[model samples]
Target: MTRPKTTPLPPTIVVVFGITGDLARRKLLPAIFDLYLKGLLPSQFRLVGFMRRDLSKLEFQTLIQDSLTKYHRGASSTSLKKFLKLIVLEQGQFDDPAAYERLGEQLKSLDNSLGVCTNKLFYLAVPPALYPTIFPLIKKSHLAKACESARAGTGWTRFLVEKPFGRDLGTARSLERQLKNIFTEDQIFRIDHYLAKETLQNIITFRLANPLFANIWNRGHIVRVEVRLLEQEGIVGRGSFYDEVGALRDVGQNHLLQMLALVAMETPATLTAASIRAARERVLKGLKLAHSDFKESVQRGQYEGYLNESGVAPYSTTETYFKINATVTTGPLRGVPFTLESGKGLPVKKTEIKIYFKNLKLIPVEVESGEVGNVLTFTIQPNEGVALSLLAKEPGLDYLVTEKNLEFAYATGWPDRLIPSDYERLLFDALMGDSTLFPTRGEIIASWQFITPILNQLNKLPLTRYRRGDLPSVS
Candidate 1:
């Protein structure tokens, strides 16, 4: 008999752990509401928020509406108002036992009302300290257990935890083991939202699909790689937290590192994620851990605390930004230092990775569009998008390179660009029990393998100070 094509289910319910926190307000809710407005949400979908906020259901919707209007980019007012109706709020303590039971009931009612066993997606957006107490609580609450039961007709449940997965290698490993022991590795989905950006995802696809580009994606043709992240604003509310996390963990270890892996990883045997990650993981391990490479390729710093932020401790020694340059330790490109910059305060509101071909100075000039050299930049945030910036020949006959850009943002109706929130996508992946995107125990261990040096240096030594609003890091 021919196997039937099993239909996939749309999202039914999302339970956010820190529903009232900054992440929930700034990114999660806005992205979800945007997903809803776009007609992507299930007809029976609902949002079940977990927080200590003392507010009624209507009040929570009001809170989310305010954020959707104020912070959501490319969102329509009418669409947002309609989305408010689909959201259902639940007030409960994150760590309390009774709270877990209350949450279970809330999910049950919504799932039953939907006429099918609905999905239970947990977004752990609370502080890192709260995860230990909350994660197991989520599991113990019978929600996580339900997901693992695999009984026919039972609803799926998934948990999405935020980063700072752990402070060091040991913690990261232990945490992964713990989570996996409870939920299959396939059941957990990690969200390094940068992966969802079309440009980064497109890096391999665009290169391979086009013979023009794929033919020379090797040492024979390429030169240096530059990863830059700039933030135009100082740490407003997350200074202390960011200070503890630092740039290495803030962006480098996760976003930048992930991007570097995607760009530099050997062409997988195939497009299958396992094939790609197998190649990527090998590249990550090839990084040089020696002190010399450490100094030249890695850097750490804290921006001078602003006067009125109240976030910086009077004697705080935490660093808010960092820059790193290092080469991969294995493969054809070994010894080529990959430079990365991450900072708390800066003049430009951008995060991008620019791959310079041949040399930093001589970029490929675009014959048309009045451009010179080809530069690919993946832009994340302010608006989620990607821009292909190339240097073109000067308008006159001179050989000077001019710059031209072809950008794709979510608002323009790019299909993949309209994917669900990083949280939503990860949660959905988790409920479906897929761990392809989430970092594995080995990957987590590997992340800290190279990352420990920077962390140790931060704890053992004084940080090099940087001016607020300066370029995050440098050569």
Candidate 2:
């Protein structure tokens, strides 16, 4: 199979805030290096790390080098050195205006030196609290204003925000309002990295580009849709944050819901970012909230002995597992049931979406109840691939049938292919000014609108408890 051609980006500089943070060291920097290794970066590109530490450029370089060595030691030193040469470090406090002013001057100096209206993409890899302060500073310093650079379409400025876009509906709206005041809608990229996963993006292609699947992707042919993101390990060290955020906000509201949108949304007229987001918005808006019977429609659970974990409140009721049954009220999938589930400390770590199609025809022989048949699954983890389950007649004279799986795995089917991590693909898109995979404000608001009611009624519902490795029914 031929890979899609990547459009070459113009000369760009990525300014990463909170450079010393764990995400930068583990995911962002390694992804940047991988892009360089794949020769996907622009000819003239640089990385600027903004932090509060008082380390010299060399010391900062050494710090990143150590981290790279620890996580990506297999990287060739020759290429690693080349990638490192493009990095420059600047030390400053996040809330200080002088720091941003100085950083802006530095960026302007680089733009002048390059003789191009250099595109700047600021990655707010910092905590959520810093957003209110950082965005205004970015605008005030003239780093991302809707001036001649962005207006003329010669150069561009974009903000790549980290997830948990807001804690709830009101907070999300407030953040959106603040962002609107600073940057245009087109300039903001609210990232949920799961959307960039190879299989996730391929979902649209699999449905729209394939006649067999597209024709049957409706309520008439499908029974139900299930999206699950399960993990086996409990919150090891992030108890403080996880306790407050819970599994619903940590993964349910964004990742699982986004997957549901992709599964239930109507096909768009085109494949542009706007078109895709519009489709998602329509599906999200069509979601039927489980307000009156949320206790029955929604379920929440905490793992056994969760309160014994460090940093958790003794009487904490935060849910570590969340599952909801939702319905789409419009489009071809109107009336179709959809289940969104996510939890930590489950039996296994897996992320997959299953489309259970109605058995249009009866079997030639008797069959047992509670048996699965005619299902298509997009397995996103463990072994990333697509699999379809079909019934096949046993090779005997008697009329007998059994379940069989036809599977395609990235590791096995495309052994020679190298799939980039989610971060690499998303970072590349941000550099090219592509918002196709990023979450829009409308989508976020719609998601919150659907989830806020459940959150408000949490106090009324009982939080179930199970053992650490036990698997709870999520159907």
Candidate 3:
């Protein structure tokens, strides 16, 4: 558990849009607090929370305090107080030009106090619809540009956008064009929090570092690859948003597909961001539906009583669950069936990738009824870890074989240290200008290209109904 040594980050200012939203309260604020506690943040850092809510400075501070207590427990009262002092809240509507003007002033005021032009990192915690409204405001106010006149143009500005980039390929491209107008591709960080997870990142290290598994990571040695992301809770108050995006666009296009790329991608020339991203882009560009017919390659499902949910259309055919059988048309995994499944209101909440290896031919020993081949699983949540299932001979007079699992849990393996949350890792990376964990524009477009056709045929596909706590049966 040796850690990499790193230089201290530069003085910075982080402005979070829609800071009053659920994502900011539950994840962003807490993660920033954790970084402060760990002394990983720069000493001259400032946090600006932009929202439409009309609250006093004290009230906003209280709100952040409550949020931190609830989402990120175990912080010392003294440390919490000190962190709150670094926060500044700006109340304004997204569409108001005056609000953007005031935001620019606030940023300038902070810089004046610090006597330096600090780097700016804007985190769009709001929905995708607000992006069009916000991006232009940022540009109009000169908030997207570096302060070249001040401090010899040492400062930089970057935007960290959340997932569900767009509804489909067409909309995604449109949004990309808008983003390009405001910021360069290098300055935009399209975040897929799943990619920041330790276990998912380990997939690359585990495969390449060990010759035992790396040699057999091709279609010749693997039977199939399954990526499952199931949740026990329904849309919960996001019915309006969920109804429009559905399961495939919400999770399948980004998280699930990214996982598949990591599993199917070839060894990178180096571990740098450019090398790894290039490898991932190659896999995504070659992905396609496994079958010619949509029905055979995709399955859609909705939880029973979904129509009764508030904000949901009476006859909405939106799917809360989807299972797609995709194939990598090129590379070592060409023609390999990669089943990607995700759903809400399932019996259990689990996220993992299972790689089923091809069965080995037995010649020297006679097997007495046992499952062959190995199943390598990388659990991404609930309990983050990796497990390998293998057949073992039972100790007895009679010959018997049983499936045994060799497992490693992060909690148990790293008992002495706290594992950073996904948002924490991602936010830190953005501040450090590390795009290694973030998906590139090419990756996003490639994923959308593969998903747009499936989305177009949703009308012809049948949506199966399942109980709230049951798994949907898919052929």
Q: What are the C-alpha RMSDs, in order, of all predicted structures?
A: 5.0, 2.0, 2.2
TM-score of each: 0.81, 0.96, 0.96
lDDT at 462, model 1: 42
What is the C-alpha local distance difference test score of candidate 1? Answer: 0.68
Tens-digit per-residue lDDT, 1-475, candidate 3: 1235354877899999989889999999999999999888888999999999999988898999999999995977899999999999999999999999999999999999999889999999998888889888889998999877434534888999998888889989999999999998778999999999999999988898889898988889988899999999999998898888898988999999999999999888888898889999999999988888889999999999999999899999999999999899776777889999999999999999999898877733444434467889999998999999878789999766777889999999999878999999999888877898999989999999999989999878888999999999866
For candidate 1, write residues 2-79 as lDDT tens digits: 112223455468788778898999988877776566555556678878889899777887888888888877767678
RMSD of 2: 2.0
Q: How many Å off is the CA of 207 in candidate 2?
A: 1.0
Question: Model 2 Cα displacement at 157 (Å)?
Answer: 0.7
Which regions in candidate 1 have their CA more than 4 angstroms from the true location?
1-11, 73-82, 147-154, 289-293, 305-309, 359-437, 459-462, 472-475
Candidate 2 segments whose C-alpha is farther than 4 A from its true place: 1-4, 146-152, 290-292, 364-369, 473-475
